[model samples]
Target: MFRDTQSSWMSTLRHDVPASLVVFLIAVPLSLGIAMASGAPLAAGLIAAVVGGVVAGALGGSAVQVSGPAAGLSLVVVDLVHTYGWRATCMITLLAGAVQLLLGVFKAARAALAVSPAVIHGMLAAVGVIIALAQLHVVLGGSPQKSAVANVLELPGQIADLHGPKVAIGILTITVLAVWTRLPRVFRAVPAPLAALAAAAGTAWAFGWDVTRVDLSGSFTEWGFPVLPQGDWHLIVASVLLVALLAGCESLLCSVAVDGMHGGRRVDLDQELTGQGVANMVAGALGGLPVAGVIVRSTANVQAGARTRWAAILHGVWVLVFAVGFGWSITLIPLEALAALLVFIGVQMVNLGHIRKVHGHGEVPVYVVTMAAVILLGLAEGVLAGLALAVLLALRRLTWVTVRKRDDRDGRTRVTISGSLTFLGVPRLTHELRTIPYGAAVDLDLNIDFMDNGAFEAIHSWRLDHERMGGTVVIDELHDEWYALAASGARTLPAKSPLKAPDRWWLPWAQRRRGAEPVTVPPDGVSECLVTAGTREYHRSTAPLVKPIFTELARKQQPSHLFITCADSRIMPSLITASGPGDLFTVRNIGNLVPRRGSEPHDDSVVAAIEYATQVLGVRTITVCGHSGCGAMAGVLSGGVRAGSLPGLRRWLRHGNHSLATFIETEGDRLHAGALDVLCRVNVQQQLENLRTYRKVDEQVREGKLELVGLFFDIGSARVHLVPPLRPTLCVKPFDRPVVAGEE
Candidate 1:
């Protein structure tokens, strides 16, 4: 495995050279035009190409992908040059490079997620618009212009500077080139640029016509020394930012594309960004334009059967040789053809259909992003806005406040919350506080077992907001300790549940598009097994978790807690509880069974776990948890799963559950299905003492570190709950409240 990883990197060089040569054929003319457009030395573009291809190739995370003075950054470079002084711009570029390197070192790839999708679209659109306009001049046999307006205004410029001979030559070359590109298999093997350049130059020489050509005098000196342009630090700084964005976006995108095509591991986004930044900085210092990954050439390389870095290196060598040796041949070709190709690329960038789809969901927000992308030409801005919209949605979901308002005995209002708090729930919490009845003693009874930092911080913020009004937020059983433990705290955030959210967009779409039926796996142990509770059921299937518990129980090592769960028929007690036959000494219940001290119990299961753990097994850590959306919970809440349907259930659930009624009695109006997660948790806490009545647990807990844990399991959600110590009070989903921002 280690050698395979090492060898994969080694092959990057062997495959890159030939591919680079093909890309070089495509890059030379583009480099000069883009540099000319940016008002930089023509040679600077070639320098950037070398750095992006050779240097970036050497340092980048991926093995293949072409890079060079990109057209995308030309406008930004020009503007920065006009504003910051090229020297200061260069300094900024250097700074940007340093920042990228630092980011990579710190593993800040996640930072890319912070950039709004809107800004990215806007940036691309701006680049596309610029390309379309600038290319029009080349298509019309004239120098490129700045904008759509300028391209139109300069109609006379092409007429006045009309080089008829170059125009005729360029047109003929383009025609032949197009033919050669579209030819059948045999002729297609010939490089289009080779045929186009040879024919165009040969035709120009035969006619002996005056035409524009590349100026290579400044690019070389005695014995072909590298001729560099003089620029101060400011220009470098301005250059780097444009280069950084271009390089970062392009390289990462290339990585994504290649990963898909090659069935390889993902590209290291952070590493690639840093490599790009460094490559741009090196190119700039060497008097080159900025560089970024180009998909067209990368595709070409891949299609050409490139297998190693040699292809890329050879391509760079070809670029250098093409420009330096037959440097004068390029002057014979006209500019119109290049512009047409760029225009085609620009058109591809605008996805109007995508825009319409986006607008359907949120028009205002999508419009703002589009405007930022098209009008301001700010890629980062639009992207940032899009990201902010997503964050707002997430925060609204996390910081939800469920206010269960029930009528009081004296006709007053009673409120209780039996759910989690998270950043997503923030908006609901705020909304609930605003809807409170005026002049009522808001009995804010909270029982949250699953909370996170964002939710915790939001709770703190809400407290200030809620207290500002006349309402009292009495937090009962608030598990702040779990929420306070910075990273990877006791309970993690819950994923969108199929049972709760039902928003798996891709799943159904994939099935429909593929026109395939779903596969069915044997449900040996699932949700049904999670809720089924009884000692006899434990011995039936000989499930892995039940066997050890049974053995230990048979051996007189009684378990301390009665575990009630869903009867999905998939959950094996031994597997979930991680016990062998004689270990757990357990009792099974549909919902995890914890009998309240005063609650009645028809079965001895609840008492069994306590007796086993305390008296026989002498174990600690008695935990009772309800798996997510226990059919029993749904039944009791919906009045469907009561013991009447399953006689034993109606009888057994009496002692093991009470949180639903407790919430309805205190606060029902503000309560919603979101708390289904919490209700399961609260039931576990209520049952902890059902063990104590077994008589052994009460004495053992006082003597040892015997801990009591309450949990809720969801059938579909990937999150697990850990109710922290909120003694003298019981809280469910407490981790949802926010006391500090990223404090853990």
Candidate 2:
């Protein structure tokens, strides 16, 4: 068993490490030459190869992958160097590297893959052509050429004037190696390219081939080490940028591909990015060239049967040994061989079939990525462009809404919508409701809590449209949630959506204005699918049959007062006092606002909460409260409250109004304020006084038992506070006795 279990790991590792050695060997010469072509020191490209293996491998991503200076970058890096100078080019690289690191840290590594495939293919093909054109001089041993068919057209003239013996040696080397590479795999590792290098060097030695080699004597240390340029902040920055982007993109792509192949899911995209960012930072600091997750070596490892990320690490060992031990030998590899390798890599990326699949979904994504990748001349720009397009597409989808209609026993239409009602969806959703018919008794069922601020505002506008259509809209049922996004469903608007008023226009004005609830005659195909879904809250659950004081007060006449309180879902004034209709005028909100406090203009909600309660229902008592875990109390207790998050709520919470300034000062940081019980008492006391700001409310309270009182009801005990009576008048200890069903 030991032998068998160990056999698998040993056999796999042995094959993969050696195979990766071949891939790495292939990568080295290309790296050195590409760096030279890009107008950077040959060592810079070697740095990329070394860093690609060393840093990216140690960071632990993508098994069997390698990284190095890539030919794909030649045109862009070269042009940037020519235009901005090497130092500036390095700075750009540094900036690009930083961006890549950020993407990895943010787990945005996969964002690049979102590019439209057609655009990707088109860009890739364009890159292929660029690569082929740029390498023409080296392949044919001619001078530098420009891009396009024009340059290609002059190839005949260029070939006729080629560096005679160098051209001949290049031709002979290409031929013999081409034939040898075609031989069986075991023989292929005999290093035919190295043999060709020997043959070419021999020809140069035998015949005075005066073609220029790497012009090394211009700069070298006394110790014969290549002289690297002294660092400037600008150059270092550029190098960092280039390294970060190149590494991030290459690594993430390789990781994803490997994951797909083995089904060995290990890397978390975000964490992997974090790791890559750190890796690049280290690599850049050490003066290594930019490194990216290279796919070829990784794939070779996979082909050789790598089971772990370790294969990547091992490949780095081989690179270090070769770079240190064979520096002299490396200088002899022909520029043409490196170009051929790049051509091969470029060809592998054609992937036309993949493009067809991506094109099927839509073209916009492809369009965006294509333009970004090609136009911007760097992977970062293209990847970012692709990400932007994908996000826009997602937002559009969110805004594209669909609506469903359901009915309860009363035959009233419950319009349930599915999808985000974003501002984008507003015009469409608004128009759809116009067809609901006037005089329609529509219960706009916003059982969905999934609406963002934008969506909430959109639905709020619908209230105006509903009223304009001559229809009576009842915001009868709603969810208790406050910050409902489009994904969670919604709470119906009370007159003006969530947190408005119960009887906004008084029952009679609504009755006089539009009858018992206008009848809606569904326009075909709407009636049968009206299946009831979701639950209903009546705001009328009686245990000790605790009733609302408003209901008791409303029984006699239209009461114009609101009791803004906590969301306990109990402590009902209507049931506790047996008031009905317009008796005990009441308004309920988390925190009460009245008689504007602060430099801010008075909110309609404060005016409206009080106005509808006092002016509309003519409520005599305006009760404000803060109960256990009251979010508003927490705001005052914790210094520096964020009013923006809760919107209307933040404004209303200022009702602890004077408490934050006056009460807390006298009490000396002892915020009977943040504490639930203390907040409840403070809320009642503060609100009783604020209610006086409404002249009508003041007049009524002085007029008898209608007097405003402060109460602190303990939720644990289910006790009702009688305030000044200094007694828990409505205490129902569950342990003492089971609540007599429906007893008030």
Candidate 3:
């Protein structure tokens, strides 16, 4: 126990201590800048940083996540300070923290993640624009106007009459920050903001420039308790809820992002929310800014190799020490330098990566509308507007339907209806139904994912009218059987069933037509061939549906993979791969074997197929697939005892002798597996080796022009596992790697 405790202490001193110092450097500059942008006392920023680090770090679920005053909340804080005095804003922060605590107790943390990311990004972008405009004035040695629009109008005049010394300092700070990351590793070891501030302060002091310095002489001495605001109750309550929800969401989102950055314990979002709540309550009571997780500090902590929450806790202690013991040092930094830092941070918040992501998801409209509304109106109103637009877009997609009508080769009309069949699409659906001839035979294919009562009635009424006019109608559902269920007098109201894959033409006829009467063979005749009956079934049910796809591939085939697998009845390559007619060029054999180029009892069949696939067809990948309970593998394991009666089978079994030897040698590594199963897996890797013996395959593989893959199918579990190729010099254990989900 003593040794373990000592080792843990050593680890903490080595990792967390250094990491805390790095985060301390980063948090101080950012916290002060955020506080300045928020129009709050400079002391409040340090107080929030200390309280956030100590309270949130000690109680939060995330191990290395750092918490402090965030730039994202500056706009809200400034507005609150303007509307209600500083003490009233503190009271509001306290109330918001209480609300957050209640929400965390109720386990509502995950619900915040359901909000559209586009809306969140837009909100942050708008806040960034506001902060940039306001701080740009300070950077130019002038006071900012009340609003973003006002600041824009006054920017020209401010630039025309800039104060030389202050502007030079601010410009120097911005230049240093912009170039910091590109500097040498030694120079960049220090945080960029801290280095920039230090450079600006040193330059100003050395040159004896007349510029404004940070005023914190009265901040610590004049601290007082928060007081209730004098405001309308309704607006006050809304303000509290907005602060609570926004702070909780940002903290939880930071926790999620931090999870992806490390291999430590995953965060409990509820606990993190509770921790942020406690930190905010403490900060507010101490006359400081609201507290939440800060991504910049957290990223620095993680990158600095922080192992536990101690890094965050220790950073807060450092902040407290500096604020009390060395308070005079902070007064040396220029206000213009901090303002320049704020402008840089604000501009970065409007990230181009986030814009590209939202644009890719087709949510650019929501993002744009939310950003514009927030900049012109307010934050809460912008969120509501974005949500309303998102809902309308969702509904429009849900009510969309498409109908395609064509004549088949058999002189029958084919009508295909797809997409959600809601009442909004009834008019288009009925119009398409009316275009069909009254007495013609029609094959109606319902390829819809969802259906409503109004859509069902429209189609059912049309089908009855057509049948009354002597037209034969056969309704086939290619997706969910919504129409069939409604036609058979089943309840279609809720329609809340889990999504189930529809029966495909590849399934057996008996399984495909479940609950339908079985087809019987004639009593006077022998058993009919299943192949003949299958082809007839395909012609009647499936051929018409896949005619277009087949037509596109009729003249030529450009399959991407040459799949070679065992000729087991249970192994369906197309079914297992979820591939269609022209996806895979397949070659099946007894043991899924690929013989060496010049081995005994040479077979040209497999080699000929490989050459044709690679040289003629230019196939990209070649796969050797094996399965569980392979009879050929079993025969090879029994030392030719199973194939003693058949000479041809004995010769084929010789090809798997190397596989048998390999399985025996590596038998100890996989004692839990059966001998036959191990041999089956080994055979796949050995076949991959045999394929590489060919000169053309080797050259192509070396040139990166072709890829070889191995697969193992478990018949009972219906799972396909990937097997990597074998290396001759270094023995690699088979079936040891993880299985990834197969692509459709």
The best candidate by lDDT is: 3
Name the lDDT value of residue 255 in candidate 1: 61
Candidate with the larger lDDT of 1 and 2 = 1
Which 10 consecutive residues of model 3 have the lowest summed lDDT? 735-744
Question: Which sections of candidate 3 miss by over 4 Å?
Answer: 1-4, 402-419, 427-443, 447-449, 462-472, 478-480, 488-490, 504-569, 572-655, 658-744
lDDT of 2 by residue, 1-744 (tens): 999989867865676567656666656655665676566666666656666666666664554455555555665676666666554555455556567667766667677665444544455555555555555566666655654455567778877777666567667666656677788888766455455656666666677665445433322122222223344757545544544544555566656766655535465655555555555454444444455555555565566566655556666667667766766665555555544444444454555565566667665465546544653455445545665666677678656777656654565666756444556776777777767766677876553334556666666666667678776666533333333333256544432233322323233222423211333335553543211210111221121122455444433454443555555465565543444554444555554434443325455556666656655565434445444555555676564265547766665565566655544554566544345556545656665566665666556555642445454555567455544322221232232222211222
Candidate 1 C-alpha lDDT tens digits along 1-744: 999978866665555554566677767766765666666656777777777777776676765666677666666677666655544445555555676677777887556645544445545656666666666566556677655556657867775786676567656765776688678888666566556656766776788866555455656441222222246655454455545655576567656566455433346777777787788677655656667776666677777666654555566667777667776766555444444445544555565854675566554464455445544544445445555666675465445556666654444455555355666666666666557665556555444546656766665666656667665554433233333343334565454211121123123222432111122223453322222322222222124334444553553443433344445554444455444334444456677666665556545555554565566665555656567666666656655454455776677655533656654654563657676656666666556545555455666556654555555555575444555432422223354421111111
For residue 631, what is the lDDT in candidate 1? 62
Per-residue accuracy of model 3 over 312-340 as CA lDDT, tens digit each: 99999999999999889999999999999
All candidates in order of TM-score, best leading: 3, 1, 2
Q: What TM-score goes with each of the models?
A: 0.49, 0.48, 0.73
In lDDT terms, how accurate is model 1?
0.57
What is candidate 3's CA lDDT for residue 706? 78
lDDT of each: 0.57, 0.54, 0.86
